[model samples]
Target chain A: MDTATTVLDLVGVFLNALLGGTVARRDRLDLFGFLVIGIASGLGGGLIRDVLLQHGPPAALTDPAYIPTALAGTGVAFLLDISPPDWSRAFKFLDAAALSVWASVGAQKTMGVGLGRLPAILLGTITAVGGGAIRDLLLQRVPAVLQDTRWYASVAVLVAAVEVLGIATGFPVAGTVAAITLGVLLRIVAEWRG
Target chain B: MDTATTVLDLVGVFLNALLGGTVARRDRLDLFGFLVIGIASGLGGGLIRDVLLQHGPPAALTDPAYIPTALAGTGVAFLLDISPPDWSRAFKFLDAAALSVWASVGAQKTMGVGLGRLPAILLGTITAVGGGAIRDLLLQRVPAVLQDTRWYASVAVLVAAVEVLGIATGFPVAGTVAAITLGVLLRIVAEWRG
Candidate 1:
């Protein structure tokens, strides 16, 4: 992957892990639970994307950097005293950032693998939301993707579509940045309006 | 794989789906929820195993028979008038059966793929309990695998270890049958005693 893409993905992982850790804390989970949820949230979406593409063992399992990055996010959550209600707005913004970057990267990777547009977009959306869905599941809550009327998953889909279109038209870098910006903005707007 | 293994896996899928459907019904979810939970419960374990193993697209998505079988299980749950109290005992029994079969089959598959014994046993347990965990998560309940004091996951781990040992010692068929029986008995006994 290009350095830009890699940077974006790492940022996404950290943000997602933060989101997971916060949720775990909210549920009164212990340290192990925080770590588990953090790692799963950070890497879960990418793992699902790779698996669907029949790529080798997920990068999360093979790469050494992933676990530590996730753990760092978890550590932040454990050390911070921010309550869920207090941080809810900031958390939404962070979640949207992670969602946008993951969607862009996931769709780009899928397209690079020569998958059809439909699967690429679908998988991209899956990649963006899969981690949080898993976090919610582990916390014994209905997944926000499935329950919320807000355009959470839709924003990811839109980002993926933009990424795919950019690749198809030979403007991949511009397309990715544009998609991420659009997705994050849409999510923030939706949350704000709601 | 072999016909015997295939049949056992199918049975596992059906029973897991039934368990998932019951949970969905209990949660008063709509039709989409029932199907989503049913499919996840039936195929979740296998999907997790396959992804970890880097096996191709999970059999649930590739094999036509899987979705139909899962759907059938959901249909039964939706149509049946069985009360939760009435089905509780029966559900436990069926869950044990599925656990036994899935554990055995998963361990065998992992070994066939040349994974080491430790991973084989762990993946086997994951295969047995993953679906139920997913079902519980979707239903907004803590997964029994993580919380229950019962020997639910422990039984599957034992079965997997036995299967791996059987393969190593050249008694595959007998070992599989014996492990399945032992697992089922352990689970049933645990439930009964509780």
Candidate 2:
């Protein structure tokens, strides 16, 4: 992965971990719960994608930066209560950004491994939504992505498709940028419409 | 990796898929739901273990037999009611047997890969209980093994430990047999007492 992608990937991990921590706080779970949920929310998607690729140990494990970044986000959430009044807008932005980065990175990674287009798109969508899905499952709820109203997963699928198209067309960098822009825009619009 | 282990592992997949199918049936899910649930229950554990090991594409995908076996189990449940009136005893037996075999095979596989005892034990427990945990999550329930009364996860932990010890002591075959026997006995006892 390039430096830009690496930075964005770590940012996604941090942001999602923070999001997971918010859920843990809402549930009144203890620190351990926050840690577990945070790690799952941050790293679960990439982990699933890498595993499916039959690649080496997941980047989440092999890369030193990922776990600590997730922990830092978790710590912030645990130590400070970013109440709903101050959270909604910022949360939405961060969530959307994370989704976009993950989708692009997932598709690119699959392509890097020489897999076909179908696997790339599938993995990209999975990489974007899987963490949240696992988090919801851990909390004993139907995944929000599976719900009719969330539209988060729809955005991921669209982002993945764009990334795949970009890579196929020999403009990987531009493709990632365009996909991310589209994802964030779509997610924000969906929330606004809701 | 051996023939006997391979046969038992596939058997475990089939049995767990049937268990997942039973859950889907109770939920009144359609055929697609059955296939989804069955595949998760049958293949989820091995997929998880393989992903964690970072060895190769999960055997569930690489080995064609795995998918078909899971489908067969789902097909049986979908085609026949196997109502609770006749399912309870058989269900318990099969569940216990599946658990025992997975626990043994998981630990052995980990050991074969030259990982330490802890990972082997952890993977073993995960392999034994992961499919059921995932199946429960998909049905929007807290995993049974995590509940106070299940004792299922506890059995898996014990089985894994035993396998680890056996492998360390160079008695892999005997260890697996002993672990399986112990797991089944303990599970049956737990159910009986309940």
Top TM-score prediction, candidate number: 1
TM-score of chain B of 2: 0.94
C-alpha lDDT score of every prediction, in listed order: 0.81, 0.85
iRMS of each prediction: 3.8, 4.3
Shift of residue B188 alpha carbon in model 1, Å:
3.9
Tell me the tens digit of each residue's lDDT in model 2 across B1-194. Answer: 78877887888888888878888999999999999999999999888888788876789999989999999988998988775457677677877878888998888887777666766776787798788878888787866653436578778878999989998999988888899899999999998897
Clashing pairs in 2: none
**Per-residue lDDT for A98-162 in model 2, tens only?**
89989989999999999988889899999999998988888887789868586888899999999
Model no. 2, DockQ: 0.20
Candidate 1, residues A13-53, lDDT tens digits: the string is 88778778888887888899999899889888898788777
Worst 10 residues of 1 chain B by lDDT: B81-90
TM-score (all chains, Cα) for each model? 0.61, 0.60
